[model samples]
Target: MIALAGAIGTGLFLGSGKAIQRAGPVGTLIGYSTIGGLVICVMLCLAELSALAPVSGAYVRHAEYFVDPALSFAIGWIAVYGPCVSVPSEWVAVSTIVRYWTDLHPGIIIAICIVVSFLTNIFFIRVFGEVELISAMLKIALIIGLILFGLVYDLGGVPGQSRLGFWYWVEPGAFGEGYLVGGGIGRFCGFFSVLVNAVYSFAGVETTSIAAAETKNPRRNIPRAAKHIFVRVFVFYILSLFVVGLIVPSNDPHLLTSTGNAAQSPFVIAAEKAGVRVLPSIINAVVVTSAWSSGNHGILQGSRSLYALALEDKAPAFFRRTSRWGIPYLCVIFQSSFMFLAYMSLNSDANTVFGWLSNLTASSTLAVWVVVGTCSLRVRWAMEAQGIPYQELPYSAPLQPYLAHVVTWFSSFIMLSGGFYVFVDGHWNVSDFFSSYFTIPLSLALYLGWKLLKGTSIVPLEEVPVGTFIAIARANPEPPLRKKKGVVGWFGRFWWD
Candidate 1:
């Protein structure tokens, strides 16, 4: 549920307008679907390993054990960095989202959101889970309702609106003029731009296992959640974007003028245009909740990543301190401090700040996924070298190292090319360019600095200790997943199991 909430946030409800504006209707679908496929591959890879290990930092721990300590050190900090910037991005979304109701200063809104999300995480883990679970349910309900609303409105099921049946797609000719250049090359640029936004939308799928150490029967539940993430991404994210493209024209001027309110949402734009006055406020309200939930999700992941680093002696020992309820209060406080970065929106346009922050988050997330893919491949190689059969694993993802290779290479390409438009004639922006490629050098420096300083070497495939963890899982196996019974069971399938 937390993962679901994390995956469907401002990127879907708010930032997607930018995607449609740049990519056009068909291009939006294509970009989301392509990135969605890559996310699925990475999720499955993480699922197989996480179900076996089920540690606090998920892949970070896996990399340390199965890959190298230095790689883990680099990627661990990157993981922490993901949420530090990401939460503020969501808070920036909150600043704009609340604009639907009023023009309250974004800094004030940022402070309120930071306080609320911080308090939510300062409790027991279950309290945080329930909050996210409710947020997830609300988000799922909102997207499904919006998708249905889009279909009805587009087909002229609403009393007065005329049928829109791909009118935007037909008129816009199915793609936006490419970004830097225009015409054919611009069309490609537009589609490529959507990839980064899509990465931001899908960033949370890989985080499901970060809570494995805190989850009950995580070996079973963690894989179940990971497997379900792809479906959620498809149904909620891809389908929602498809519906948005249908009802709202890609060329709508409102798409580009992101006011950080419901006015910027494509669905709200459709609703207001079609004389459905009430829906925009409602959509905006839910989106505010969605963005706030995403902020909470980011802080949770960030603090846990920091805590995991301390556990591995990769960070200051103070981060390992916890409350009686097992909450990492120190780590949470440290991460919450980064939320002040949201105040940057007070100085710049909230939309511009959002773009910068989202770009940074997406780039770092791509780097983390690359490391995850590497860890997945290493795990497979270790298993092979140790003569362990796949059947012995608690959960096994099909396709083995092939999926890992494909996603790793693809993510690397996307990460490197994220700022390609900035280099094109008449399109260069120094800040934008750095946001795209900054993580590349930062990650390399961290890896090399640690490797050179510590003289750490990659663990040989034959000595990765895969068998030790496998034995631990075997010794203390979890109970089988309970079967749902009768009406309650049917409801459980939808709400949560």
Candidate 2:
């Protein structure tokens, strides 16, 4: 549920317009498909690692074991920062949607949303998880409803409207003809940009692994969660993007509106064009829940990452302190601090703050993918060096070291090209450039600074301690799930892994 809800946030609801504006309809689909494939590959790699050695920090711990402590340090804090900013971005998103019905300041909405999410997370993990599950269910229902609504709106089901069909696709054509060269190159650039933008939306699909330490039978559960997440998120993103593009043209001025409401959503835009008067309010209301879910997810991820770092003595010990309920209250409080960054939207509009925060985290998310892929490769090499046959593992990812390398190189390319728009003539902006590519240098600085301070080196493959983790896994195998052999067996495979 966390994975489902975390990845279905403002990126799909709001930032998607920027993707459509930069790329055209067909191009946006292509970009999403390509990145979707990469996400699947990353998920596969992560499945193998997390199943082998499930832990609280998951990939960050994998990086420490397979790569360098310094590298892991860089990745860990960035992971923490990513969610920190994301919580506030979701707060900004809530305010963005709230502005649709009320004239209240975005800061007020931001405060209310963050306060609720903070209170929920500080006391009870189970309660927080339950709320997230409900949020996920709502998000799933709303997406399907929105997609169906878009289809009806697109086919001109509304009264007094002509059958639109794929009229927008032909009217504006497929490509948005970006500003790079204002032609095919711009279209291609636009498509390339979507590749990176989509990364942020897919950020939290690793939640299953994040929760691995608490999972009773992680080897079984993690694979099921990862595979299901891949299929579900892929379908939702592709179908939603297609429906949104089919209904509203990429060039719709409303797509770029500063109102910071769901009115800027292409789904809302399409319905309004079809003469539907009240759907934007409904969509915005549901979207506000998504924003809330998104913020809650951010707090969970950020606090856990910081707590993990503190456990490893990388972060201040204050973060390691917990409450009577075993909740990492101090870490939660620290992570919640970043939510105040949404206050920046008080001076600017919520939309501006959102774009800024999205750009800042987008590259870091991709960088994490790169690091994860690299760690998976190293883990595989360590296994081979230790003479552990792949079949002996609790779960094995299809396509071994090769897929890891492919995902690593591909994600690295996207990370490098994240700020490509800054290079486009007549589209220069310093803040845009800084926010888009800043994570790269920030990561490097963190890595180098940690290295200078601690002088940690990458673990060599032959020296990698694969044997110890493997022994632990062997001693404590994934608990076997039993059920009736016929119809129930099939569901057992999915639900019980």
Q: Name the candidate that leads on TM-score.
A: 2
Q: Number of clashes in model 2? A: 0
| Deviation from native of the Cα of residue 469 in model 1, angstroms | 2.9
Which lDDT tens digits does candidate 1 get at residues 1-497?
67888888998988889999898988989999999889988988888888888887888888888888899899999999889999999988888878778877777888899888888888645677787889889988888899999899899999978888988888876896556676988888889999999998888888888878889988888777886877867768888988888988888878877555558878789878778778888888888888988898888888988988898788999999999888899999999999999998888788888999999999999998898899888888888888998788888887877999978899999998988888887878988888788899999998999999999999999998878888999899899978788988887676533
lDDT of 1 at 185: 82
Off by over 4 Å in 1: 123-126, 258-261, 477-497
Clashing pairs in 1: 96-260, 178-186, 178-187
Assess each prediction's global lDDT (C-alpha) against the native. Answer: 0.86, 0.83
Superposition TM-score, candidate 1 onto the true structure:
0.93
User: Where does candidate 2 stray beyond 4 Å?
Assistant: 124-126, 479-497
- Which candidate number has the best lDDT? 1
lDDT for 178 (candidate 1): 58
